[model samples]
Target: MHTDLWNYALALYARPGVEAACLQLQEDGADVCLLLCASWLQARRARVSDERVCALLALAEPWRIEVVQPLRTLRQQWRMAAQGDAALALLREQLKGLELQAERTLLERLQACSQQWPAGSDETADDWLVRLAPDLCRDHGALDQLRAAASALQDAEDGD
Candidate 1:
């Protein structure tokens, strides 16, 4: 299975626009390690090889350690700094635009993935959306936008 999926990844990687999307996603901080692993899987087609996946996960260790973990720490710090509801409210408004930027980056990544992968039926790549849905919706109505985008894609595909 891993072998097949690796071939699929190669096919996907070779797809005309995929490399550009991949590069942009990397620039957007979409977890290069995970992207590499997914790319491997997409090329190979079969289930990803455990050994390869493990090695790649190990490589991503630093990203988790240096990037995401620190961000979590900072979020905690921000919460603590709020002092009270009014302060929290002020911080929330101040951070809204930054949050929107992050969401846009993520949604762009997801749309790129959908464009590369087949979106027919239940096989659409739902896992990515599942992981991000909560954070994208946490502070805004972006979930509705996401849902609408997804719905439009589904409808368009169904029409085809």
Candidate 2:
């Protein structure tokens, strides 16, 4: 498995169906960054705990509220306008970049905070995914697809 959260995320997200699954999960109000982190932890075999979940949530919520959401909101709001106006489109593209950067920063923070967590626990990645997933998406199929994709990514790595 990849050692860094960002690369792991990029790899996992690049997998077939993973991006769509993440988009679906995002639509259901789950944090994609958190979901990616959960997948990373699961790949790493980190044991999930209430305290760890709480810690990750506490670290992520504010950043999402203060940074990521605003960029995302603005970019989404400009979707129509950006299509008609080249200037607006450029600005929207920049906003998209900013939103991506914000997400990247959040991933970095999550990785930094969770990197020290030791592995070798009985907790499966499903435990991490389920624990961190929003209640709204607890039973969603996209979450299952994400899990399956993660497993496939891990399996591919294991083969290598």
Candidate 3:
């Protein structure tokens, strides 16, 4: 299990089905960075309170909206345009890297904000997931899949 948030995120994200699960969660308005942070916290057995969850979201929302999403939108918008022009494809790839870096920055910020919280005995990954995305009822299936994937990864790491 990696102690650093960024490494933990990369390893967890590389798990089977996790990428698609994360994309599905993102489509439902969940912040993937926050979700990854929550997974990290859960793996560490950290305390997950409503207040802390809210605080993490508050810290991450602005960055996600202003930086990550715009780059993502541009990359998506350029998908077709990049198909014909080699230069456009190169530029879109660059934007994609920027978007990834922005997401990494968000994860770092989130980890820094919550690093002081003590581990709790009562909360599960599902608890963090629900608090992190309260409106996830719109797609219960996707939410459940994410919860399962995160929990599985955390459990795997903890068992190591």
Question: Which candidate number maximizes TM-score?
Answer: 2
Q: Candidate 3, overall lDDT?
A: 0.82
lDDT by residue for model 2 (45-67), tens = 99888999999999999999999
CA RMSD per model (angstroms): 13.0, 1.3, 2.1
Model 2 vs. true fold: TM: 0.96
- The TM-score of candidate 3 is 0.89
Which residues of candidate 2, in runs, are more than 4 Å off?
Answer: none
How many backbone collisions does model 1 have?
23
Ranking by lDDT: 2, 3, 1
**lDDT of candidate 1 over 58-150, digit per residue (tens):** 544554566544544555567756666787757655665454344334334433433443322343342332232224232333323333333
After TM-score superposition, what is the CA distance of residue 43 in candidate 3 from its true location, in Å? 1.5
- Candidate 1 vs candidate 3: the TM-score winner is 3
Q: In model 3, which range of ten residues has the least summed lDDT?
A: 120-129
